[model samples]
Target: MPILRNTKKEAVIKDITVIGGGVVGASTALHLASLGYQITIVDQNNSNIAKNSEHRTGSTASLGVLMGNIFTRHKGRSWELRKRSMEIWPELIKSLSTEELPIIVNTPLVKIASSKEEMIKMENLIKQKKYLGIDFLPDNYQSLPIWIKNKYGGLISYNDGQINSLKLIDSLFLKLKSLNVNIITSKVKYIKRINDNTRIWSVILEDGKAINSHIVIICAAAESERLLQQLNYKLPLTKILGQAIKLKFKNSQVNFSGWPAIVNIKGINLIPEQPDSLLIGATLENELSPDKKYLHQMLETIREKAEWMQNYLIKEKWYGHRAKPINEPAPILKSIEKGLIINTAHYRNGVLLSPACAEWVSLEINKFHQ
Candidate 1:
């Protein structure tokens, strides 16, 4: 272990440095800290270049849906990751007693099928997953709230929920500060190997200072590939661009905060945010310039199902990139070298997979000592 030393030449503590301060990085650091590891987090906070970049990264922009049994296509790695995350979410939320935790709205999700074909597709999917606590509503849509429109019925998935992404980020930041984790708001220029024979490394910051540590975990999202390539590891990953908007209803009687989020069979989601406020999103594009026609099509899809949205205006519009491994659906969690690990490529499930990803990485860190 590399000892963190003070100017007095005294070995204070052994340090574990985590790069990327986004939800995955932050959550990983927190889990390591809780396990009594002296931790330091290095993040540029520059969205343009950092892999685990955090300026309105997917974590902040997400509608915070823990979508285990909702709109997912199959029970693949994506489904397993979400299932594990949902299992640990409550315990993780309750553990944050240092401050008021983020608002995790434990409401059902209403998956509305616009056509009989779509309904049949959803019904077959339900059978494949055999998920509990979710039931297809009556053909008359009796169980769904009065606000839900359209003619077809819906499936209500219990315990599927949403959270305030901004608030959740705030709470995580606060908890990290309280834990005395050193958070450096600077870019890591690159990593330097201290020795070839020994498993030791140092992160070279933009300011030319080297932060030495025994373990260096790279949670940088799309940026991880470049950093790893510099060290001769080829990580095949790509970035997908997505856009979403927030809207507030003009009518005071319209309240969605307590109602279940409406997941259109056509890939649009309406998540309740605050009183009369809702989050509608998101368009995924791989190219730099998203096709305007495709974006318009998504908007048209949303309007077709929920005519009530005509009463509200867009409150905010934003777009960001999500990371995905070239061929893998699950996140990449592995030790690249003796003291180096990489955890990224979460794609659209970053928020949903935060806890599970953090736990998986932290366990690897623990295993290194044992």
Candidate 2:
């Protein structure tokens, strides 16, 4: 491992260099840092990207949104990894002493349905038998309650929970900083094939500075595909455009309305961060940004959810790309080269899967030394 000074400001290098500072990159750094690896991060956008990538990306989002259902589809080892990852929040909270972590307290992971058919679909889903028992959540989210039941979200599952994604990313970055991870601001210009493309490699920053390492993991979201292709590894991945919104509400029935997180109807999901306000999102597509047409549809969806929303205006908006690997629901963690690894195609579970993903990657890094 390279050296990191205890002093406040010093330009010391590290053994690991991560090519993104978003949640994935931050989580990757933090996990490895705890293992005593000298780490570095690079990204053009900081925490603010989560605040508003909608207008900036020309995308519009609705009140309810989703990341698809990794929770409901897990099987065996895949299911176990997700469950264990969900349980990491408590330790994550203490690690992030700063920013008040988003209230991920147990709330109903519901399938609130508007009609009988949908509710029946929910009933049939939970009853389906599989060794992994992946079909646990109701088929539709409408079956959920308006608020928490019995001081919590009810006996939901052993491992499912919510997170203030953006805030969580911010907190992770700080924690990694406290761990002395070096964050370079330039984009990665190219990769240096240390031996052969299949054996060892390093990367060159856009500025022409090369960061060599014994092991490298690519956590660069949609860019993961490009990274893999550059290494001659075939990865089945695609980028889906998603939009999110923040709305200020009025007289609402949803208690804990300010802090409840739900995967709501019409592909809309929300996490109310404040009283009378919630962050709603997500539309899926191959496009890079949301056109005006898509944005208008989003507004209409929110309007249909609650008549009272007619009075409530948007407090904020955001848009971003989520990567997904269609071949397998689980992330692709196999080595593309002897010294290089791939850790992307996480889809919307990016935040949810960070801890587990990082842990998996860190283990591989440690195994390299052995």
Candidate 3:
């Protein structure tokens, strides 16, 4: 597609280049386009995978599924934004309609209460959060149809949704096309300014193609550092390795289980999906052997808590690095200098937090004008 031009000054942004086409990058692209910036999304997977995950195995469920996890780790603005993300999630889906909508599947969550005190804590949290405002606590346990039920009443977070990550990105990519945003299949090396009078910026690609823009945003994950390094920009970032498995429990699938997304778990989380597939995520271990026995242990850890999971057969497997941002959310979207921006380090909650983070970054990019 040709570069879109606008006669109105409000629509004039020298062009913005979003490097990395994953969740953070992809979301940034969409939001930037909405702001009327001539935007180009650069990715190695442009024509092939096009916005695939690092593990390529991300939870497509609603942000609501991870609310419990965030609550335990955050309390102030981070907590508030995460909660807001959950609220905005459904509405965003309605607007984007970019991917196949998540199926409202029942989840079979297996929660283990270590003791009476733990159970009390769980019960109290459910009440407080529920009584206070939007909470993760599910209201019903007795009405469940599945045989799997917590005798001590494991807190169930009702009304969670799930999506296929790959499909979600593709949908968003399609939506960008409708807005005339361009996505290129290549890697960005650096951002350089040319023609000072106009303040026009050019994105130099590894393949030697120079794409011009007014602003450049970095959204790539672990690779964000290397790309930035070429320009002498470094942020405290680290790569954490993650592994998971997908299983299908055909007849035993939980219909009330909205992916049975787990939260506040100590070590790992088991997120469920339609029909029989269960998404099992494990420890944030690094330098570990990829031995079959090790992978089996991760699966076993997830299956151990759920007697229901034993019925499922393995369908798919996943492994990838999640970018751990140093400091906090502010680092990724903060403006380092003129015409240069970044959006990365979303670690575990990338999918859940993508929209709000993208909106924030896009707005920051727009702020350069003001």
RMSD per model, one decimal: 5.9, 7.1, 5.3
Estimate TM-scores for all models.
0.85, 0.76, 0.78
Candidate 1, residue 217: the lDDT equals: 89
After superposing all C-alphas onto the true structure, candidate 2 shows an RMSD in angstroms of: 7.1
**Which candidate leads in TM-score?**
1
The global C-alpha lDDT for each of the candidates, from Candidate 1 onward, is 0.72, 0.58, 0.60
Error of 1 at 190 (Å): 0.7
Which model scores highest in lDDT?
1
TM-score of 1: 0.85
Better of 1 and 2 by TM-score: 1
Model 2 lDDT on a 0 to 1 scale: 0.58
* Candidates arranged by TM-score, highest first: 1, 3, 2
Taking the tens digit of each residue's C-alpha lDDT, what string does model 1 give over 201-282? 8999989999998889898898898899899889899988777777888976666644665554466777776768877777
Candidate 1 residue 37 Cα shift, in angstroms, is 1.1
